[model samples]
Target: MPVTDVTTDPEALTMTLVAEFAAPPERVWQAFTHPRELARFWGPPGWPATFTEFDLSVGGRVAYYMTSPKGERAPGAWEFLAIEQPHRFEVLDSFTDERGDPVEGLPSMRTTYEFTAVDGGTRMTNVTYFASNEALEQIVAMGAVEGSTMAMNQLDLVLEGLREYAQGKGTQTELLSDTHVRITRLIEGPRELVWRAHTDPELMKKWMLGPDGWRMSICEVDPTAGGQYRFEWEPVGDTEGEAFGFDGETVLVDPPRRMVTTEHMTGTDYPSTMNDLSLVEEHGVTLVTVLIEYPDRDTRDAVLATGMTEGMEASFARLEREVMG
Candidate 1:
């Protein structure tokens, strides 16, 4: 199986997370359905999970409790609706009270987990449905999306580790969080040098990937509010690549200081997720902060799972060389 892709639509209040695991669908199914295996990798890093009850059947109930490092505990329960062994499952997940009773009036989410064979492994998708768009919006605004993405990334690590362990390769997978992969590099060069590297077409070509099929095409930027920019990452050789392009609307443009862009990826054709870049000077060092806002947690998680931190580090290193030279 290949890497998974996760995405969300905040306006629609929906999220979809897809991943490919190096295991058969049945194995993956067992990992998700079995209480003992599920408890081991269910929560975010440092969060301990205990499954009080898990009934893997339609009309049955599954309940669990999670305690953070600080000793605070949160309980949740789920009612299974459809259960097809090793292939698909549907359930309604909700918060529970101390007595193990479901909390009334709180949002209960409907979730469907689907598994399919791809290559020699399994392709799994987790789709969560909220009651209403308003509820979805509220949760996203509260950062649930980002937090969930982090959790899924942790799940990826767990699944990968399990696969390796099954093959007698390693002991366990290392737990990782979103912050671990986020990039924050302090630059010593002037702001203009940094800005030019990001904005200038010639300089961008040296670093950024181009569009599919076309080797190198035109790169343009308006650099002002309401302005647009284009990015292309072309394919090499015979293999076809997903077209890499975005038409972004500039929301903020404070040259030598900050630039904010709202970009919509081509496939979704949705509103732009916000990207904010800020340059601040402290004791002669310029700190660059790149903030990207996605539609939901799943989308953010998918990006983080990809080795984004390493990629950013390399790109910044190249930028450093270009600016210093």
Candidate 2:
């Protein structure tokens, strides 16, 4: 089992568990932050988890349920209180009803997860703080320790499969759910430079053009929260294509790390979508990841059916050649 030690301090009203993994901190962090990865082991062997909503931002909440072999569900929710990137995060965890509201009479706990680099791998310290001694005892009596161990023990297989999942793949698309899709591309460039290429309008105009026959007619970028951005594209000489543009305002911005924005096609009544973009650098290459949340399954399907993935791949290839190259 990954969890090697479990300790309870009644006086402190805290239960701490330490787990070690044979992987780096980033990979372990990803396992917890990404709903798809977390679902693989979030529940014990017999039960599987399905995250209905996963928002990895401060003040955002995550709602999920674990289904038993007999089709019973145990719902849970987390209110994110703090986040410090690849090191630590804190959340207010509670048992909830089917609607994701905290259940009355059930004990709620404050949980913190910390990751540290160790000799050969990463060590994760998970601590849960109860409101009182009675609360701590109540959870302990409910097989909290055993359940946690079983859930964490299943993380090894998930961790082991991550490297093989994305190592050599170029720009790849993953259908995270009916309304959510994740697209990732590992580009041959540093994180800061890649961020610049994305936020700088001049640089964006050069390589953001998808195919060879198109040109960016207008480009306006503001990579800050509440700032608006617009991009218009038209066919170049003799090319057959109509003009199109997109408009959106930045919702959240964490420079060189992450950004969340609302996006919609300009002048269209189509519902807007939220897109979360993140950049992580490893081994001299930066992985650009975008998680898009569509309004509904129909809209998601319609967008993906528009050769979106191919166009993104072409633009990313252009980014590598014309900009980063």
Candidate 3:
């Protein structure tokens, strides 16, 4: 187990858990900063977590929910209090209502995380301070310790990069949580071309077509934050489906590296999805990563069941062959 020991103190009304990972502090810290990486180990076994929003700065808050096997949800929020690079951070952690407001009846805790470099690995000292002994006992009685142990143990797999979709391969999808999926693809071209292929309407229209019988009829892109992008595709001939399009607004953008958008169907009652796209170049190849968040588990399942991954693979293959080349 990554978690070596857990201790509780009634006098101080605090609980502390010590965990060691065979990873550096910087790598371990990245797991917390990246929402997709954090979601993999944030919930206990049998309950998967979904983080809809992540604000990494001090005084910023994050909203997340863990869904039980029976479809029950436990919402939570975290307000960052302090951050010291890759060494330490603190947060006010609380159980919240579905709207992400802290519940009046639940006890919130002041949690501190300290990461130290020890023996070429990192030791994380996690401490949660409660208001009173009763609050401490209340949380312990809820099996918080055991659940946390399980959750932390799962972090070893994440640190090992065991869950990365496909390495040195085409488009591949990995389920990060009940409502989140990550797709990655390595393009054998420069990073600039990859970015242009996504943002430039002329380039997007060439390779964004899903299958052989479909053609992109409309490709309007606005890459600035708060701007909108609309893409539509139609069956060329002898193709099987009606025309479809997607419209989305840019939530954030860092040219050549990252972009975020909230996407909705051009004409449908379907729930909207948040997509975080990032590009990283190593050596001569560029890797494109997309983390997608669905509204709920049902919506996630329905979307994935529609052959979304395969369609994405087809588009990415076209991008490599036709656009990036």
- Top candidate, metric lDDT: 2
> What is candidate 1's CA lDDT for residue 46?
37
Error of 3 at 299 (Å): 1.3
* Predicted candidate 3 versus true structure: per-residue lDDT over 264-297, tens digit per residue: 9988988899887867675577777787888999
> Model 2: how far is 282 from its true place, Å?
1.1
- Model 1 TM-score, all chains together: 0.49
lDDT tens digits by residue: candidate 1, 1-325? 1335667776666778787777889888988888876775576433446799888778999989876433457898989999888899999988899888877766778989999998968888888888798767665675665556555554443455422322322111222333222234666566777777777878876655422233435578888768888776566688575546666777776687667777776556555566666554544545555656666666667766776565566566556565545
- Which portions of model 1 show Cα errors greater than 4 Å? 1-3, 10-12, 156-325
- Candidate 1, lDDT over the whole model: 0.66
Question: What clash count goes with each model?
Answer: 8, 0, 0
Single out the weakest 10-residue window by summed lDDT for candidate 3.
161-170
Q: List the candidate 3 regions with Cα displacement exceeding 4 Å.
A: 1-165
Whole-model lDDT per candidate: 0.66, 0.86, 0.85
**Model with the higher TM-score, candidate 2 or 3:** 3
**Ten-residue segment with the worst summed lDDT in candidate 2?**
160-169
Q: What is the lDDT of candidate 3?
A: 0.85
